[model samples]
Target: MDEQQGRARRPGGRSARVRAAVHQAVTELVRERGYGNFAVGDIAARAGVADTSLYRRWGNLQALLSDVLLTRLNAQSPMPDTGSLAGDLRTHAANVAREVTGPDGLALVRLTLALSGEGQQGLQARDELLADRTRQLQAMLDRARGRGEDPPDVLEVLDHLLAPIYMRVLFGAGPLTPDYLDGLVDRLLA
Candidate 1:
């Protein structure tokens, strides 16, 4: 909802205030301290809301963090549609590379990997966070197919295209330069 619509519905409701405060605090904390060492109490203090409020809203730190991560991801870079498969793929890969190379993004990835291996909840959260990007790529591929251009398997294309970008970010192999992104697009299109 837009800001006016949100305000009209609640008009300074306590629940809305608490939710907004918690979200803001979580985002700030993640950007500052990384997700590896965040505590509920710290978030509550930062938000100036009771710990119970957060617990009631999110159930646990993991769930709250997952929501926050997904929100930020969606806001930072929306997947673009450039009309051409090569253009669209390059744009998508470049956006991913930019995020993965950032400090906040690296922390999010580490937290996601660690949590996702623990149980079904974590895995579900990970899948939810990735669903938008997955759909975006799939739509781009579908558009290409409709235009009589046969691309490789969508998942294979994503994995092959994103592998080097992740490697460079996760392993500190090299910088995520335009040249690297261009090379990835060329290889994928070939």
Candidate 2:
């Protein structure tokens, strides 16, 4: 509807502000106190929203955390397509490397690991996160195949590429140097 007809639009108005505030609060709290250390009221107080608003919107803290993690995941690591499978893999690995090494990245990784087995909600969140990642990888690999490139299986990519970067990040093994990232992709494609 048009504003001339007494109908107005509020794109990213109050709801968006509240959502952004809540997401920020969740991230900050996770960084400060870690997962399972804060309650719904704490989030509401930090976000300047009512507790009922959170419960009504997200049902529980676990659901809210899952949403935050998934949002961060999708926002950070977008799949790349660079004509060749090697280029695509290298670009994608670089994206992931940058994401995990970013300022909020370590806290996010800890949160994901912490949320893996708290309860039913935790399991569901992990499953959803993995499923989304799998879908993204599959889409990228399918694109490479369409280009007549022989791409490795998604699992192989995970093992040879993503898993190593994640392990390095999780354990502070070493810096994710470009040469190292390229090497992982090279090994996977080899």
Best by lDDT: 2
* Local accuracy of candidate 1 as per-residue lDDT tens digits, 1-190: 2563355248478766776787799878877886656788999999998888677667677777776776677767676778878877788888888788776667556667856775876777677667766776687788988988876667776578777777778888878889889888888778
lDDT of the candidates, in the order given? 0.75, 0.81
**Model 2: per-residue lDDT, tens digit, 96-155?**
889888887665567667777587877777676778778988998999899898999999
lDDT over C-alpha atoms for residue 68 of model 1: 70
Which pairs of residues clash in candidate 2, taking residues 3 or more apart in a chain or in different chains? none
Runs of candidate 1 with Cα error greater than 4 angstroms are 1-19, 31-33
- Give the number of the best model, judged by TM-score: 2
Q: Give the TM-score of each candidate.
A: 0.78, 0.86
